[model samples]
Target: MRRLAASLATAVLAAVGAVAVVGQPAAAHGAEVFPGSRQYLCWEDAQTATGQLDPANPACADALAESGPNAYYNWFGNLDSNGAGRTEGYIPDGTICSGGDRGPYDFSAFNAPRTDWPTTHLTAGATYEFQHNNWAEHPGRFDVYVTKEGFDPTEPLGWADLELVGSVTDPPDTGGPGGDNYYYWDVTLPADRTGRHVVFTHWVRSDSTENFYSCSDVVFDGGDGEVTGIGDDAGTAEPPAACPDEAPGAPGDVTAHDVRATQAHVMWGVSQSGCVTGYDVLDAATGDVLAATDGSPMVDLTGLDPGSTYEVTVRSRNDHTGAVSDPTAPASFTTTTTTTTADNAAAAGACTATRTGASACS
Candidate 1:
């Protein structure tokens, strides 16, 4: 792969060190090229609130058929250890997305020749920041390539078909939660490039000989980061079947804690049904409102009297419509008595049962 030149700052290199994990193959760490790679976008399309792959897009559904469910689970890691920068000769022509290896096997199906794969729309000759996920941090260089104009998507992709657009070593780590550090660099799109093309990324690890490969389907129209073929619409891809409308189911595993002098904290599981948008908490003893929330699973009952017994009940709600669920069997808890400094000393002096059921005190 050719290392195309661009003036990247050394300060960007310093940011790479902060994220670098001491010992691990770049295997744990990989990229999701934006506009977006096949696996990355498909993985996003298939995911649900329950962490299930309920594919909403047709191309993603087809990919699920080819690669199976486990492939998307490891979406970022499309890599080959022995690549060593030999792009064309080492990796076979059509199997570029899978890195020409079956070691991380399920990805091979993504290399299937097809034109209907999910695509990201872009404006030609426009400058845009290329974003990649730093799953597990590593010291490597990103080599970006774009398919030449007049490249056909119906056929398999090959090295002869692509042109090296730009390369950057240690791109700045734009922060993201839970190690999804997005590395970004500004690259000007090819002025002559137009129509359907692939933005290929080659991540060459400086720490090891291993290299990662990705294929991002793209169309050079006049678009600006608006992804199609996703969401509730049946725009080229068929949307999943509609969920039936009913009252949201009750939340499970309700619990209470922090039974302090004046307040108690309560929480519960989110309802399994998609209809649940929020929850209504009630005082189980008096059937009065304790608290209600549209967001969090937890709520604190404040202004509660000390040494009082209080029970809180939770009900899942569907905010879209005015439907509330049957209340969960109430989680009953008693508030602890308010204590003074003298009470602490008196309690400490008294004997209490130990782990062995024997009495002990200081």
Candidate 2:
């Protein structure tokens, strides 16, 4: 599961209101790999030797055009920084696949209604080995859901159309982080399930409020686990040059303010020569991207460890090139051990990470 998020880089945590967010994670994530999710399949469908967007499928081509190639490049990152295991009502109806359209990259275009999405052929009522990628390993639970019988593939998916099938808590994981390695498990498809349907996966991390969602288009048409609609037969030709020169340069004037028990605000100056789609907030100590935000110049980092000091850096992002700038000067802040209205999440009632770590209010 190269589970990258949509282009909505901001890690927004809107409950009944709104909280401004900018930037998101570049790496350190995961997604479904066995029954390939739309992003995964689209990435596979469009992955070129040149790292450019040239999909053979119509749906993948459209998604690449609308959401850009980074949607597939960082493919395993479609996660929300503030999900907290909340589903259905919290994630809305049609946008379930994109984690309510909140995460590091733009995956909203993948929610489009199309049946031609590269599909996996499987037989109904079969016990199959399931695999979820561990591109970035974290302790978590993987919930498996499948669409109900007589499901319509041409319409936007809604929660009502799905039924929880199985779940595994921190299942056995193999392979190293940042590789094809994955968490493996066994899933028995519902015998009643047939025809066109989707296998939805929700990966809820135990250590944080972050959650990764994957939507795999599949059919129980009496076939094995053969995938269709992707063309890599001819293989590598002279690859086209991707849009890398347009990658944004490093940002500067980085600063953090409004520090609190579980939150801090990061701001930076972007004077790059090219497009700067968003910023990635990173743990300066680990170099792992903590969260992603929109194109805004500032972002609020929530869910900090109280009384702990942290140093962070901001890296400018270019979604088109999937390139991130060098780290801006590190900015440091310490979380206040004391609780506050912001930390309490009085109105929003949801929070992301700060190190960024995950914390949620009751």
Q: Among these predicted structures, which one has the highest TM-score?
A: 2
TM-score of the candidate numbered 1? 0.59
Error of 1 at 165 (Å): 0.9
Per-residue lDDT for 210 in model 2?
82
**Which regions of candidate 2 fall more than 4 Å away from where they truly are?**
1-28, 232-362
Alpha carbon lDDT at 338, candidate 2: 93
Question: What is the overall TM-score of model 2 with all chains considered together?
Answer: 0.63
Candidate 1 lDDT, 1-362, residue by residue in tens: 11212222232222112122213342234655477788777766664443335667777888887776546655665787667777878888998878886444368878866766777788888888887877555667888899998898888888899899999998886663113457778888898888888889888888677788788888888877556665454243443343345567777667875455544556576566656656767767666655665533554444455686767788877655668888888888876688433223323432332222112121
